[model samples]
Target: MARLGIVALLAAFGLILTATSSPAASTLRAAAAEKNIVIGTAVATGPLAGETAYRTTVAREFNSLTAENAMKWDTVEPSPNSFNWSGGDAVVNFAAANGQRVYGHTLVWHSQAPSWVQNLSAADLLPAMRNHITKVMQHYSTVDS
Candidate 1:
């Protein structure tokens, strides 16, 4: 299914490339700007930040960016009390630098959940989930500020 999506995207991009005079004239962001809807891509922070080709394509082709897995429960909160912001922060910082809007992939999910969450009783799940969300949002408050 994912491979089909990629193939379809490649086919669409090929059409766009053939229709335009140059690569710069065929940006998804530019087409989306005409329609007033944002065009975005899920990107890995490391490649988006460190690889020139990936960074350049993302900045030029899309107006918004989403972290592929950096914002997932397991990646952000691996243990009970500890939270890691580095991965998520890197994506946000890169998006800001490229003049792209940051889209949070998800706040919580059953998949990729930490062991602590999996062990929790049904009664305690809600509070723990709320706390996790609050902390994540608070950590990124300055983005909106």
Candidate 2:
């Protein structure tokens, strides 16, 4: 009876070890890949850059990512003819490093639009929109879709 109890305990310990051994075995990315599906999430550049847990979860569980606020018009181009691509670039680079595809979020959304853009004249609005869209798209041309 003593030998049988030891064997049962050892088997239980083995099962626990196997269950906790590999995190990737239960990842959403792996499960999605099995079904020919792409799992993705919207990522904020702040947490992605600063938080190890956030970055690890994003990379481990998702096969694709979209910039949450990084790609917005207000964030990318806060002033007329001026651009800041750092946040957006960070997201794209992270995705690339993790073998994940990037989904471009938005070029011209009314919400979170810059004050300069909102104040543009009708004639100037179209040109400004075109310029913003063209520049953003060109910058991320190398990103995987």
> For every model shown, what is its TM-score relative to the native structure?
0.81, 0.81
For model 2, what is the C-alpha lDDT against the true structure? Answer: 0.81
Over 17-115, each residue of candidate 1 has an lDDT whose tens digit, in order, gives 787774444567777786887777777766756778777777787888777889888899898768998998998888888888887857888788888
Off by over 4 Å in 2: 1-25
What would you estimate as the lDDT of candidate 1? 0.77
Find the 10 residues in a row with the least total lDDT in model 2: 1-10
lDDT of 2 at 128: 92
